[model samples]
Target: MTTLITGATGKTGQRVAHRLQTLDHDVRGVTRHSTPRFDWHDRTTWAGAVDGCESAYLTFQPDLGLPGADEIIGAFAAQAVAAGCTRLVLLSGRGEDGAQRAEQAMTASGAEWTILRSAFFMQNFTEGAFADELAAGSLTMVEHTVAEPFVDADDIAEVAVATLLDKGYVGRVLELTGPQLLTFEEAARAVGGPGVAYLSMPTEDYITVLTEAGLPAADAAGLAYLFEEVLDGRNAYVTQDVETVLGRAARSIDGLAGGEQS
Candidate 1:
């Protein structure tokens, strides 16, 4: 049976697909551009993507915290199960209410599911939304004193691959985090050198900056919400789930910043 991967070209999705392939697992990575053309917004395209797949890795676009995400994810899970894809893995946020709702919906779908409730990704600095700003030598945000134990994307992908292939991890909700917590300013310095500047602005101003920088209005607003509401020190702690799942210590941001990870 095939394993389906949504968001196949995205950060974690790409990594998961590659790792599964390296392990010689049959992988069908689906995106809006794939041969099957799986689109999150277009329910018409879902059946073809889920057909003949025994398992799937789901990473919702925009985010799972958006309104109506629970409904959409629930529907997708039901479709996957009906199509005989019994194993489902979801990429979920750490401390978001909407994410929890989506999780519940997936669980209620009756598929064997594993939820990787992950911390802020370390790759946000190197390869994500903040990459351009960090590359420009300045990173700005709606600054708060809250620290986050940012998990490496590579670690998350490994865990996803493990859980998808191993039924022992079925029905588990693994909270994945790095070994240490770092505030935004500290993270900025770690990613760039000490000369790099970290700037804090009001939430609205930050949203304006992102929109002006060509980010969609909804995406900018979603990012602003995550920074202002979700980054309120609720997820400052680290977890051993990654170590437990992978049988190795989780990668630290320091290692990533030092070019230890390629």
Candidate 2:
């Protein structure tokens, strides 16, 4: 049976596809540029992507926090099921209502589903949105007090691969986080050595920065809201889900600091 991995070129998705291939599973990696052309915006492409795949690793593009994600995810899940994809592992965010709605849709799709509700990714400092900022020797964000348990994309991919292959994880919702929590300042220092500076700006200023960095006004505001609302002492704790699910502790920032990123 083939396992289809959406966002197959992305951080976790790429890692998951490689891991599945090493494990000798039939892996079908789907990207917008793939032969079947699985563009998330084009519903017409979904059936072809799901065709002949017994399981799928579903990572919503941009994010599940974006508008209309629930409908698209729900519809895609239904399409996957109708096309005989029996299992699905959805990569979701920790504290977004939009993410939860998409999770609910996946559960209701009648496919054996596992949800990975992950904390902020460790890759944010290594291979993600903040990588450039950190590399530039200065990391800026909104108010500095909150700590986040930054989960590694590798751990997420491990859990996702296991969920897709193992029947025991069916219908489970695993909340994944790193072994420890760290503030943006600490994370910056860890990722880019002591030379990197961490700057905390006001919400408006941060939004302005994001806008100046090419984010649309609404997108910038949404991120500002996320930083202020979701990251405000809410998801500051750690979880053992990585160990519980994968039989190993989640990778820490220190572990990632010495490794190659996707």
Worst 10 residues of 2 by lDDT: 253-262
Candidate 2 residue pairs in backbone clash:
none
Over 4 Å off, model 1: none
Per-residue alpha-carbon lDDT of model 2 for 1-262, expressed as tens digits? 8999999999899999999999888988999999888988898898889999999999987778767889999999988999999799999988887789989988889999999999988898878889998988999989858899988899999888888888999988889999998888888899899999888988999999999999989888877876777777878888899999888778888978888543
Root-mean-square deviation of each candidate, in angstroms?
1.1, 1.6
Model 2 per-residue lDDT at 234: 71
Clash number by candidate, in order: 0, 0
Candidate 2 ranges with C-alpha deviation above 4 Å: 260-262
Give the CA lDDT, 0 to 100, for residue 19 in model 2: 93
Candidate No. with top lDDT: 1
lDDT of 1 by residue, 15-128 (tens): 999999999999999999998999988999999999899999999988898778999999999989998998999999999988999999999999999999999899999999
Judge candidate 2 at residue 42 and give its lDDT. Answer: 97
User: The CA-based lDDT of model 2 is what?
Assistant: 0.88
